[model samples]
Target: MRKGRGRRAVLAVLFTAGAVLLLGPGAGAGAGGPGSVRQDGERPSFRLRTHEPHTITPDEGDSIPPLTPAFGNTGPVAAPLGVALRVTVTDARFDTIALDTIPRNCYLAKYHRTLICEFSDAVPAGAAYELAEPLPKVSGDYYAVNGSYTYSVWPLGDPPAHTEDYTAQYERGKDTAVGLKPVAMSTLKGDGESTGDGEDTGDGEGTGDGEAKGGGEAKGGGELRFVSDGYADRADWGIEGIKLRGRIGEYAEASIPEPTGAAQRVRVEVPEGTSFAPLTRQEREGLPSEIDYCTRDAEDGNIYCSNPRWYVTLRVRIDRRVEGAEGRISVAEPGNGDTNPGNNTAPIKLEVEDGPTSIDRWVPPVSGFPVEHDVPLETAGSDDLASPPEPSVISVDGRTGVILLVAGASAVTLALEAFRRIRRARNRGGRRVTP
Candidate 1:
């Protein structure tokens, strides 16, 4: 009976404490935060796979689901990328889908069809996200919404000696193609009859479309004008290990839009005493298919792609490490082809100020990554640096902290009250009370 009484008292206290803990103000918000970031023990890389666009309507009520974007990351730490998905929703039939007040974390551009949305939280590597959007009432036209997630990465230095701005002009690719002309423009003859387009020999004039001289089919011919196809979120931290000791090697990547359209060159200008170095056997094997075709130009030692392609990802790396060396790698100016000179020539620094002795081995060309889709850290702050995290570092959100404190206090008070009741019962020559 004594044991039964003790058990009853224990159960009552535990239940009361748990209730107090959960009822604390603003609870449950931290349940799915960074604490949930997964560490799958894989090399840090980004693979963004898009699903076939689907349609949602107000008829579906509050059941509009988020997109299951196949965006994965295999990095060291799990932190918010401040990543936003810019979705361009257009009315396929009338071009009148206005961007107005939207749902959770989504904002609209005043005069554009773009809707920018921030997800619930930072996603870990190898995970997928279902992005949210507002549903419309009309069903006359299907919307074609497209966009990409843009984020940044920089060096890891304590009391960071330097923080690179990495402006959009230097990082992102602008007008991909230029000088694209048409072969001929349709024109009309003096007799008021339709004639084939006027021959366009670099002169910008368009003649009317013409039917063949006598009812035969007239084929129109012209040069295809280059246009922007997709968003160039322009950033790849590269896949490789960084060893601090004898030689330090790494990769820098550029995200360009198209493969076959423009003239693009990837130049890796290393610091003095360090030219574009060699890659290991493993590194050579995992290179995207275009390595052989886009090798270093014998004339200038940079990789040039005159006959551009879609498969060759813009991955530039210096394989061999140089002891205690630091410099920046530059993607040389891509001549006339990249009309927007703004993003043509960007430089990235490869700093080894504080050394990492050994880096994790990464065998790239990871299986299951889509051929083209296969694309792709921050330092700690001063206070965090000065006072290192201790073993007993208790990290908790405000709500969680409050809940724990309340629970602890309740448990202590219950225990004291129960003990007093038991003592009074025993002194009165009766069985000790459990309450």
Candidate 2:
């Protein structure tokens, strides 16, 4: 009886070991569990997480203490990893501090609302991966308050496996007063419409058709205004010219701030087949002397100008043509203090008027060639056709050459008349003509 009991115990132990091997880590244990092989047989399991600040407050510039996100591999085997970060803000104005500074491996998608990052480095099991450089600073308008921003990180190609705490409340502090606002007009002149106090309504209101009302005070004590006239005319010779203007004003309520090293500028982009040309002395007659213009480069299609007198004008010429071409005009690097950023850009459309193109104007029609004319050539010199004038070589130019050319033409005319007469006579007698 002792031997039989020992054998039964050994058999039960063997059975349990077999069951563990067949059922994986434990009974009822799911795939993706610790040390468990996935049913689909993918090599890596990832734990991605997003770390966001509890509260964000807009400062004079970019906010400090940016969000940091990370991902880690949990499986036993090392494998390539991909990460996707999605930051949905309460307002469209809330965005990363600078888009150009994002990681090289990361790319913006879904209208810049998402970032997909694929790591080139192999992710070793149990190792965490976080951004080496500082992440973007989350920013919002000065008036943005109590708005929430949510962010989530997951495997790049998989979304259902996101972390449990994917969405969190992002608090915005009280409204910050300093900001920049830009206003644009489709034409050079703004309509004579202003509030009774000659100031904008402070609502950032404007027409959607590329023209906007004036943006109130250059908040943050900045006094310069950059404006561009968005009209381009295509000349008959296929070149276009544009004129840009600027306006300067004082902030009576607040003193104008001193110019910083990163001074504001107006940037104009010429249509593709065209480029910016420096204005000639004649063309710069009425422009303000304080406004400095960029030098001309044929290959460069952009123009940059600065300074803002009460009425400053800058003229640029685009000496090439591209049909139906459109360009953009805006203020570059508006800085972090800007309050309103939407009204900064306008469109430049090249106008093509009704008429013939340059091609039609230069080339004459080739139809109805050798027109049948009733007028006949005179053959009065037929007697001199017995021997056609011997060919002559002349190297002289000018009036002497012209006289020789006229004499040679006369001899050729006589020979052609003689041939015509002989042909007519032979045709009447059914014989070949020899001239």
Candidate 3:
């Protein structure tokens, strides 16, 4: 009996030791436990993505939705490009998804349409992710509404220095073509007929249809006329001669004479097989009489004047009598206008439309500029540049709960074994107890 009791004592001690070992470490392994304390001094690096949500409304006669903003380029020099994006629609009835990465100002302009946005960042290559499902088109001419969508972006490869967030607002408009033309009485009247349908009931000599025939579709019909005596007047109107040329559309191939100091050239496009009349004597006579007033005498006795110094006022008329088509007519003299000639000198080519003809502005060849990396010496040894650790999500579900309950029961059993051991040891010397 003493040997049996000795074995019981040993069993009790073993069970108690095992219980303490299991429970002590297991309970202390939580997030804020000893291990976490050791890692507290370490910093984590991360890349972030951010963007605003957007809603768009179509104009009265437009058929397609506008271009939507997506993720732009990310990464410092020599780093791999990374991109992450998510687009989900809560309601799938009226919205359709189309992705594009055209670099215009700060927006995204719809391709082949009048919609425009101001997005001016390079998009990362090979980092596009889309989840698109078409919505049913609503019946009738009523506006179709799209359900709200949420978009989230993250770096796919490396963490970014910082994440950006933006929501977009879109507005749609009907697409229409603008016709440019030069001003002349006969040309204006002729344009009126071409631009208008056959309905000419308005004022006599007017097409009544509200359409104007722009410059009779003549080939090279509206070329600027220069005379041997030179152009008239400095500051004839509000425009500078050199600056004025930038605002007008080029329709023909023409050269400005280098020796004449003429910085501006005007040319107009005409339809195939059309010819324009030469400047009439009367029109030539109308040239400003003050032409010699702007001439400057150089040491060689040759006269010289900057093209911007001369300005003339030309009239513009639009004939809206035609029914279907519309037209514009502009006429201006060679010029330096009232404004400072040097003040308005932005690059004319830069101002020219760079994207599709339907749009008015140029998109940059590259969207986003790559990030620069030249850290200071003080920060070189810091762990702030370290990569972020992978994140693990904690979840509480039925299965987890069941496992926890089982663990708790196991722990309780361990306690009972330990208690039994202690009680038996305390009653060691006593007589046998009744069952």
Give the candidate number with the greatest lDDT: 2
Q: Cα RMSD to native, each candidate?
A: 24.9, 31.9, 32.1
TM-score of 1: 0.21
Candidate 2 structure quality by residue, lDDT tens digits, 283-397: 5775566644543333344565444431323333222234666666555323233333444555555443332223212221122222111111122244522333333554355
Query: What would the per-residue lDDT of candidate 3 be over residues 70-184, giving only the tens digit for each residue?
Result: 3211122211332222222322222223322222221222222112222112233323222122212211111222233322332233212222222233322222211112222
The local distance difference test score of each candidate is 0.33, 0.36, 0.27
lDDT of each residue in 262-285, candidate 1, tens digit only: 223344444332333344568769
Q: For residue 88, what is the lDDT in candidate 2?
A: 39
Clashes (candidate 3): 39
Residue clash pairs of candidate 2 = 179-338, 179-339, 180-338, 180-339
